[model samples]
Target chain A: MQASNAMAALALAVGASLALAAGSAGAAPPALDEQLDGAAPVISVPWNVDAAGTAAQAETLLAPTAWAEWSNVLGIDLRPGGSGMEFTSNPDYGTFWCSNGSSPAYAYARMHLPHGSTIRFFRMWGQDLSASGDVMAKLRETCLPNVGPAATPTVTDLATLQSSGSSGSFTVTSSPDHVVDNHQCAYVAYVQFPSCDATTSLRKLRVQYER
Target chain B: MTRTPFIAAVFACAFLSSASDAADFPNRDFRVITGVDGKPARSDDSYSYASGNYRCTNASTRATPHVVRYPFNLPEGTSVRYVSVYGRRTSDATPITLRLRQVCQSQSASDPTSTVLATRTPAGNADGYFISAMEFSPSPNTLDCRAWVEASFDISTTACDASKAWIQRVLLETEPSDRIFRGTFSVNVDYTLP
Candidate 1:
């Protein structure tokens, strides 16, 4: 009876050690501190007037055609010139300004974030290019869950920048409902004229978000 | 008895390694399906059926004259890495310029309303039915092929989540002049998932 008891005790000890090892191995990585509000992430694309010197240069900086390249080029150029464009920390805000020429310009800024991030707020400062026409800004999101030939993505409009006249600045905050499941998001700002001759200039633009 | 624990450890290690090696992002390929004639099939599982001859009257002026669209879906954590297109041209001398677009469910259902992603003109070969391939970088700043004319937007994001997303669609228009031709084309996409 003593021998049998010894064998049972040995078995139990081995089983317990194995269970402990398994538990240690399965432990998850340390969680990020949720209490601290880190610096907001920022992605900026400053406008390069030099790059747009020629049609081909504009196409290279923008796209193939005039109509297709305008908005995309403007989108990349909205950043403040110099070292501010560097993406070192998560920036809570961004600035977009354009003052030169105006011929019904539209711009978009796109960024990719870790999935499940939330956009907390947006701040805008702008001077209307035209006294009669209004400028509009929109926040758009697209999510691609699986990357393959069979994969489809969902697109949603998170928010819209309130229309501003020739001069004004505004700040808007997003609700918790603004959280996104996908990784890709963008901000589109456009200025339309009543006539083909109208033009608009954007002096300031910013966005804030949390991962 | 000790050998049993060692075996279990080995098994656990193997499982963990394999799980890490498995594809985080899905890769997909589409191919052409030919008929009995051995030529490019007009309508099959591989290609979408379009009425009438695929013609480009003023290829240079025509705005997305002949567009062939293939629908796809990307779940949540995945983003595009590279997109490649392969096809044949009727004349090796006549280069074919094609534009690739991404149609998101939230954006637009129609092909014309979709966003233009990239454009490429594959170099032609002497052989009439020679296969040509072109690749596009996932970034809007770079072009994988010299023939690429434009890089409008990048698809490196997890936001493409929908049941009916148009992953790839080609807009065929005449770049040099008017032309009418029948050819076969397909797309292969590489992606990364979290």
Candidate 2:
């Protein structure tokens, strides 16, 4: 009995020492990712919403060739310079603004955050070429009623941020209500560039969320 | 003291060591982004919310011209294992296609590069629902370390056929690059040294 007790104590002591050595020798501490239940860590998703090769709708009733001339609610025209989208600037017509027409023309980019994700913040990467004109980004959430007949879904702006200078990025922190409740909401990231300077553009959007 | 307590202590130590080792592997991560989170590829491709999902219908008469791209924001060095797109077709003749696309941009290059990892089009059931899946193999799988990944869904039929397709959700299954935790940790859990 004494021999067994001594052996067990020695084995435990050796095991504990080895474990302490590992923990001290750069073994990372237990983290959320290390959890057995598969709880997700904070993940940041980057979206290049302004990439080329996609088409947008035109606000005016025109041919497919002219649809890129006007910024539509679905999307916007890609800038001729690079991988970005901007409002169309026609020499014949002045700068087109979303607030100009009877029907507002705000460009939209679909947001894909993981289900049950709580948005921490999102960054808008782009250039605001004009100092006078500002670029606005609004995170809109529309939740359809579960028990109703197709009524107009209540649209809410969870957060909105903008920049007027030639900044490369703008970060908008989420409020308490920024959770992605997919059971009742659909999220859309909207960007409206009030300038037609050709350089004023929206390049990319990054969403950081926790699941 | 009794030998029972000593044996129990030894067993407890062993269990703690095993847990620490298990932490090295971490848990496989997954993300299920709904189809409503995606945007239409063009204005002519209209979408309506139905049953808590986006039902997209193409307006163009061309074959498979309508597309909806869903962006993925996983960490760098994320080994994507499987991609499954959930959707249904309104017409029996039409099929829904899911494509896994990766884009890599070099610092010296003027244009960003892109590649298609996999493409799958699943057959619809009697209820018109289908789950298009693509799985990668050989251990490491497809790593999205320095690239951008997205799942683009294409409606296989022409708009003139009155066949519409909508995605219910996209499931992305991935494993960490190495046997270590590389990203942020949850603040809710209290982690301590073993």
Which stretches of model 2 miss by more than 4 angstroms? A1-190, A195-200, A206-211, B1-26, B59-64, B76-80, B104-110, B124-127, B135-157, B160-164, B177-194
TM-score of each: 0.29, 0.44
Clashing residue pairs for model 2: A45-B73, B77-B145
Chain A accuracy as TM-score for every candidate = 0.41, 0.49
Candidate 1 at residue A176, lDDT?
25
| Leading candidate by DockQ | 2
True-contact fraction per candidate equals 0.00, 0.00
The CAPRI category of model 1 is incorrect
Q: Which regions of candidate 1 fall more than 4 Å away from where they truly are?
A: A1-116, A121-131, A140-158, A162-177, A181-211, B1-83, B92-94, B97-121, B125-194
Error of 1 at A1 (Å): 27
Determine which window of 10 residues in candidate 2 chain B has minimal summed lDDT.
Answer: B185-194
Please provide, for model 2 over A1-211, each residue's C-alpha lDDT reduced to its tens digit, 9 standing for 90 to 100. 9999999999999887655443321233221110123224323322222224222211111112100110011122221222233234211111222322222235665565445776654544444556566667787788898776988989988778676454433222233335678787777777766644444445444444555
Q: On residues B92-165, what C-alpha lDDT tens digit does candidate 2 reach at each position?
A: 53455566654432111223345566777666566677777777432321111111123233444445233345
What is every candidate's C-alpha DockQ against the true complex, given to 2 decimals?
A: 0.02, 0.04
The window of 10 residues in a row where model 1 chain B has the poorest summed lDDT is: B181-190
